[model samples]
Target: MFSRDSRAETRADTAKPGAIPTQPPRFSGPIGVVSSAAAPSYQPASPDRPTSILGPDISIYGEQLILKTKGSLLIQGHIEGDVHGETVTVDDGAHVKGVITARTIAIQGGVKGELKGSNVILHEHSVVEADIIQERLTVADGAHFEGSVKKAKNASEVTPDLS
Candidate 1:
């Protein structure tokens, strides 16, 4: 059986004089008593702080393959279902075939479904064929878009149903 008092055994061996300590110094108080400088800080992930990426080699296919995240999402792969995030970016050479709902959507690839966001940008290399609802819509030159765009009066009022 393992001994429970392992810290007692880990005390510095003081039998030999002028010897380097074999163990690290131990704290004797409750865990939280340690100073912040000596403790590891824990940070919660904020909805607009983290960025998640889907690599180019990955492919998602399903009837209801919804990818939802509180933070940003960068898709460099192929998705056959809906995507919801705070900020969604479909990189160049990527492909998506379902609805995309986000606060901001930047498409540099190919999308074939609905896109609803506060701000939507279609880059020069993007190929889109979806109906878009956004407060601000920007289509760069050379961006192939075959969809209708509906503009909202206030960007904050247009909230995409992330469900």
Candidate 2:
């Protein structure tokens, strides 16, 4: 059996020219070795999926119930105020009672206020009763809508200044 010193010497002899040393380098400062378990995993965000979600049991009331998101927003509950997002989706059984402004707005539930978006879609199960201002508007068959629709020239033209 080789001794510790002999083992190190053997490693040195077998190493390639100008190769890194087999032994870990000594450091005077605190070591910062990061293992896989300690390191955080990164995932790319998806544009089609909402980053924020309001569950079915959730209910937001009052005029201060304004929800604004830079990413997509999904609502499965009841909201009594304005909502603004990059993409907004009102799921089935959800209800909104105020204005909605977004780049893209999809409704599968009920809306009772103005809706302004670059692109708007009302599913067959949706019920909307408000004025709509959009670059593109689509209403599926069986969708109940009682609103005036105004189409814009482009998405940029329809984008609202929420600030």
Candidate 3:
């Protein structure tokens, strides 16, 4: 019959040479939850984190639905509203029918409205029917676009206000 001491010895025996020893986590300790009341909420707006996503199963349609975020957003659904973010991407098979304002906008879906961004990209297999105001614009081969594109003198001119 095995005892507690034997189990400890077995675990110790399994450790590799020069490897750092590990201790069991203390589950009895109080766990902290992220809350707005305790600390200021920090929204990460960086290339490492694609902070938000509208999944393909989601569909938002209303008179005026405004989605605003300081971070990056990936939309793989249908949205009939305005989107404001630092970086906004409309994924393949997605459909949007409103205005999109961001620092960077990449569309691989169907959009039928206005787009304002410092950098705008229409990928192949994308269908867009919207006026674009951008400092830099890229339209790939096979991208169907039926709208006028206006260039901005400065990148800040096309960047959306994240306030």
Question: Which candidate order results from sorting by lDDT in descending order?
Answer: 3, 1, 2
TM-score of each: 0.67, 0.66, 0.68
The sequence of per-residue lDDT tens digits that candidate 3 reaches over residues 1-163 is: 8334654432323568776657531111101222223321224334554467787999999898889988788788999999998878887799999999988787878999999998788877789999999987877677899999999877776777778
List where candidate 3 sits over 4 angstroms from the true fold: 1-50, 153-156
Tens digits of per-residue lDDT, candidate 2, 47-127, equal 554356687899999957788887767788999999988777787799999999988787878999999998788876789
Candidate achieving the largest lDDT: 3
Clash count list over all predictions: 0, 0, 0
Work out candidate 1's RMSD over C-alphas.
16.0
Q: Which of 1 and 3 is the better model by TM-score?
A: 3
Ranking by TM-score: 3, 1, 2
RMSD of each candidate? 16.0, 19.5, 15.7
Q: Pairing residues by index, what is the TM-score of model 3?
A: 0.68
- Candidate 1's displacement at residue 83, Å, is 0.6
In model 2, which regions exceed 4 Å deviation? 1-50, 153-157, 160-163
Per-residue lDDT, model 1, residue 97, is: 99
User: What does candidate 1's lDDT look like per residue over 1-163, in tens digits?
Assistant: 7335665554333336666666543221111212323331223235456666787998999988888987777788999999988778887799999999888788878999999888787776789999998987877677899988888667654565556
Model 2: lowest-lDDT 10 consecutive positions: 25-34
Please say which candidate is ahead in TM-score: 2 or 3. 3
